[model samples]
Target: MRLEGYVIVSGDGMLADAGGSMPDSLKFEADYRFFSTALDAVDVVVHGRKSFEDQPNSPRRRRVIVTGKVASLADDPGNAKATLWNPAGAPFEAACAHAGVTEGIAAIIGGPGVFAMFLGRYDTFWLSQAPRVRVPGGHGVFPGVPERSPEDILRASGLHPTDTRVLDPAADVRVTAWRRS
Candidate 1:
């Protein structure tokens, strides 16, 4: 199965501000369209609660939410097409099967922890960066921040940039596809 990750972070490597909210600076129309289109092709999306994509089709889209609240895998109370998966109690394949996925792309969206969990499994990681944006006292895309770059961690995980797509040249918003080295 193909596993992919998608995230947009500030130059400082932040996913959101310290208040745990996405700042206006990270919102770009081009990026949104790109992300949404990419998501539409995935068979299933795996994420933590905070990483759930708020898209129009989210209600019916297959999803596996990584959470400790469930012992194994359980149907999501909020969404019929979603499942709550606890890796500690159930295997990933089981979660995927429960989420109605046997193969195809499994998109890993993030809230840091979720992104780090699949670091080594990603077949491709699409990283979007807004170099000019800085979210002071914000959440890093990975576990360790300002000290180590997200690119550094991705490199360590055996992924390298394979291509770049300029989403918004004016805002310096660009996305690079990282593939296994």
Candidate 2:
């Protein structure tokens, strides 16, 4: 039940374009590398239906796609590696068990709602920033929440930026890990 989160946002705090997809201009090898590396250390990957569907393929061995349409893991057949989960119907632990993930970090990859679900529960949040990119009318990382910077939202949830690293200098992208204090 160690929930961790990851998001790559633009300078204007946008996680997705107007079309609700990641901006093509923001794609950088270094940012992707950091995300892949973070996923390597997690046992289960968690995301909303939009994010899950957007990524037809992934490196994650086990994933739980949060959706109200399905009651259990057997509902999703497109990806044998993933388990469909309705949080309203089953507990998080049960979803993990259904995914064959008994214990370890559960990485919450985004689409806003999924990130908000783990608001106060994230053990760590790896927030990567693309400084030069700005998605104006784009979706915020936590869409429905009150207007606040991603850093402020994380801080309000009791997570503080404890460490930072440059992921791609050429793209001016850097990642910061916010750990729960």
Candidate 3:
């Protein structure tokens, strides 16, 4: 099975601006385009409880949220497209099996700790490096990966830059994708 992940972050490595602000309208549009492209290559998505909460609603894919509390769509009211489970009790592989996604891509969206838990298991990572924006005390690229240059981590993870394109240079963001070799 191929496990894939994607993230849209600012140049400074912040996924969201301070206070969890949504990406700017332009950035959001670009993100949706990248998301649609990346998502087309996967069948399932695994996220942490925090990431799940951050989203307005569950996406239209076989979604899994790793949480200690049993998740119910009714409980969230807005999460109509996901099934929640406890990763500790039901391993991620088992959950994927139950979702009938035993092969192909499994995209792990971020929330740092979630990525840390499954980083070693993923086969590829698709990341979009938006132009640099300074956000004081905001979240960085990979929260738990120890403070280091993003380039270093990407290289260490066996991912090589496959493509790069400017997205509103005036906004100081560009979208870049890296693939595992």
Candidate 4:
């Protein structure tokens, strides 16, 4: 199965503002467009606990959230779709196997540790690079990994840039895609 990740980050490498605020309206729209595009191609969506918690209720497709315990959305099941799994015992590969995603696309959204766990296994990466934003204490685009040029990391991850376009040339946000060889 092909596993991937999709995220939007500021030029300074901040995923969110220092106060944990979300992207601006325009950025949010662009992000949603990318997310929707990814969802349409993938049979299942897998995300870390933080990503799951940050999402609003939605009942559109099957989603798997990797966490210590199975997540519950009973209070709003009508709007929340997808299942939850704990990746503690089983490795990420096993979890994907359990989801029956033996082929096609399987996406893993952010939360650095999760990315690190599955980076070597994915076949693609869809990254939205926003223009520089100054957030002194904000979270970075990729945390935990050793510091290196984004290009080097992408190369080491077994992925190479395949396409790139400016979502808003004036704003300097470019959405790029990389494919595993």
Assess every candidate by TM-score: 0.97, 0.91, 0.76, 0.77
lDDT by residue for model 1 (18-60), tens: 8877888999999999999999999999989877678897776
Q: Identify the candidate with maximal lDDT.
A: 1
Q: Where does candidate 2 have its weakest 10-residue lDDT segment?
A: 52-61
**Residues 52-161, candidate 3, lDDT per residue (tens digit)?**
32333235666766677763221234465465667666777777776666777778886666665665666766666655544555666575422665556777767777
Q: Kindly give the stretch of ten consecutive residues in candidate 1 with the minimal lDDT sum.
A: 52-61
Off by over 4 Å in 1: none
Cα lDDT of candidate 2 equals: 0.83
Superposed by TM-score, candidate 4 places the C-alpha of residue 72 at a distance from the truth, in angstroms, of 15
Per candidate, the number of residue pairs that clash is 0, 0, 4, 2
lDDT of each: 0.92, 0.83, 0.63, 0.63
TM-score of 3: 0.76
Question: lDDT per residue, candidate 4, 1-181, as tens digits?
Answer: 6788877766656566655555562265556766776677677778765664243423455566666764332112433445456666666556555555556677777665666667677687877776565445666556532255444566787889999977766667788887788
Model 2 earns a TM-score of 0.91
Model 4 segments beyond 4 Å from truth?
Answer: 18-21, 25-28, 52-58, 70-81, 97-100
Clashing pairs in 2: none
